[model samples]
Target chain A: MEGCTIIEFILLVIAYFIGLILLGIYAHKRTKKTAQDYFLANRTFGPVILFFTLAATNFSAFTFLGFAGKAYDSGFGQYGIMAFGTAIMAVMFYVIGRKVWKLGKEKGYITPPELIGDRFNSTSLRLLFMGVMVVFTIPYLATQAIGAGMLIESVTGASIGWQIGAIFTMFVIMIYVIFGGMRGSGWTDVIQGVLMISALTLAVVFIAINLGGFEAANTMAYNASPELFTRPGGGDFFMPMMWFSFMLLWIFADPMFPQIFSRFYTAKDEKSLKQSMILYPIVVSFLFLCPVLIGIWAHGVGLDVSGQKDMVLPMMVANYAPGFVYAFVMVGALAALMSTADSQLLSLSTMLSHDLPFKKRKISEINIGRMLIVILSLFAILFVITSYNPREGIMGTLVKTTFSGLAVLCPTTIAALYWKRATKYGCIASILIGETSVFIFQYNILPTFGLLSAIWAIIIAIIVLIVVSYLTKAK
Target chain B: GLWWRQSEPLMFGLPFWVVYLLILTLITSVAFYLFSKYYW
Candidate 1:
């Protein structure tokens, strides 16, 4: 990129951060000085804000950049997997989200593990859940930093290296969370969500027009590689068993994600949650599928994205888009990264400061929550600096592993709400065995049965929960 | 079964998966609307 173009992109990014900080300060001024208000936005999110925040928090730049690259390399089957998987997740929101939201409001819960521990009446189980969450969440958090760095560098053509970009990204999110907490995060998410959806829609439409519309572009892609448009898809991306495992992972494990689960507590009413669910599949599909289409278009036009798959979308925008459009899309991509990072940082801090068995005699819970946000951001920045050079499909690998690990908690979460017979021992045993089995299956230490590790872990978890709960009833 | 493997007869210049997913999005949202109204 030329120096002028690089300057334009940098200025655009700075402008976006300025907008976010102002929103953060506004939220901070409006929020009450209480733990519930700081962490849960006093449970006052309406349907529209609830919908955008949840959708934006669920996806990261990883959805657009990483999914596009994966689809470009693996074929449209990956897109199908993501689109359908997300829709299934929305369905779960109707059943699980309502139950969780009602309990959260009645009991004044701050986090999911807090509800789980209180329901089972076990501090140890809560601590165990927090530990599992922190471990899995780190990589997912690091991906945001990595993605921000890659996006900035690609758009500016290495005028800004990914490391500095990552650092700046970390700083922006931390500042917002420190200032606004959940309210700030929610406000910023609404803006980012709208910007991202618009950018993706516009990017696809522009790319299609450039490549002679969707019909011609689809024809070109089909002629080049027909398998990409088919069921099994090119590159043998969709194996039957693995696809089944992925579907199961999305349906069961996604709601258990800390950031997503927090939205259940943040929603104001049942109708709001329901309205968010009703609108989610429609918005989410377009937000995700547009990038996949752009990726296919790039491939059809014969852009080589090998060895650096995750940067394909950025590369396409840099090459084909006008300077103004390039800067706007870059802002959108960074918005996606920051939206998720802010929520994850807050969720991690909440777990460490509140959900875990930590005494707050010396310091207030909200202050400790603020301190942990800085700590986690610094920790993630260090992880990003060390593990900067990830290989192809790194995004896909990190995301899948995180989901599988979180899936270990799926049975426990559901049972805590539904099964009165569930015991503390069963919950703890389920978590330990489920988490360990997920790692084992992840590394192929155990037989996978050609399924995802999460599937196996969940199977083991339910058995352990049942047998152990039966063997040792709750006193 | 080749039920999912049918990619030749394209719909609206898109292939099977693209059309199927687009249609699936509409179906899912409508289903969610009804489920939320009555069942949920």
Candidate 2:
């Protein structure tokens, strides 16, 4: 992977910034005055916009970079596990999104903590959920920062220092987010999201042409290793992982994950919510295939990316494609990176300002949101200098240990929503039991079963919440 | 595994560029129309 010209890199960055600045300014003017408007786009986002936002927002750096990397490294073995896990993630959205939207409307909830607090009718229970939320969120945020630095380095030939790159990336994002809220964030995501799709799609076409055709990728990936081609959950322990991935959706119970559920509360009504889910997965399935193609193509050609599997897209394009195609492809990779970074920075800052506060003291929620944008943007900056090396794939960073930790949250949330008898005591007991059990296994012991301890914790937690709430006559 | 990368010009009348953009458009159009009728 060589010869990314200085002129090409600068022009691309310039074009990107100009487009972003124009949108950010327009969105700033369009920005509404209320807290609800700032955080949730005043609940006015339509179908296409919300679908792109969810796809753009949820499909983080990990998908763009790490998925390719893992495919390069482990090939089909990783694909089956990750692909199935991700598809299940979408299904979870359908089942949980409707319920969360319904409850959110009735309760007027703002963050995940709000759901927990309202459901248990207790401050402490909400606090427990909040703690888990913050801890898990940091790593996810760090993954974005790590991605930002890599994008700059790849295009610029590392001419810019890590500190300088971090500043520029964060500064552009913070200004728009601070001024415009979801209006700015949403609009920018549209731009970046489009760029992302264009870029990845371009790379796929280029590689597909070079490698022969669409079938070549899968054929090569399989002939290289036949065992890897099967569906992910079709194996011995596949059900457990599928169940683990499926159950992880209880995060819908958390109100602060503004990327998706915020759409629910602000949605014009239940119809938009239902419709988005029905069609959203089709887009996901289509977009999902592109990078996998690039990975398999790279594999066939012997484009060895070593440890940093995440760099497969950039490396393949740079090493193999025509210069024009290379420039265009970089846009998609950067698009994925920026789409995720911009929205997340906005969400993270909002949660800190709005959710962290004990009470809404007369502070203009919009200004406070902007202020937190600047503060949290610094975290990405810190991650750049320290995150010079690729840590792991996107699945590693985004999913991580939290997938299991979420199991505990799931049982209580289900019991709360579907079962009226679920008590506050039951919620607390479930979270404590489930999360502790996950920690024990993640750190102390490897599970005899591949599914791990989180599932077990969730099972026990559900039993406890049900039995206790029934016995105590829960409120 | 043996097929040539250059053989296929477009996967379904749209090249990768056209295909992904089409996917994006189809989703947005359907969702936007529905959203307008229902929420907007």
In model 1 chain A, the worst 10-residue window by lDDT is A387-396
* lDDT tens readout by residue for model 1, A249-301: 78887787899998899999988988988887788666778888777777678
Candidate 1's displacement at residue A150, Å, is 0.8
Candidate 1 has an lDDT of 0.83
Tens digits of per-residue lDDT for model 1, B1-40: 0146667678756665566776787688898899888887
Q: Total clashing residue pairs per candidate? A: 0, 18
Candidate achieving the largest TM-score: 1
TM for every model, in the order presented, reads 0.97, 0.82
Interface residue Cα RMSD of candidate 1 after superposition: 1.6
TM-score of chain A of each: 0.97, 0.87
Fraction of true contacts kept, per model? 0.73, 0.00
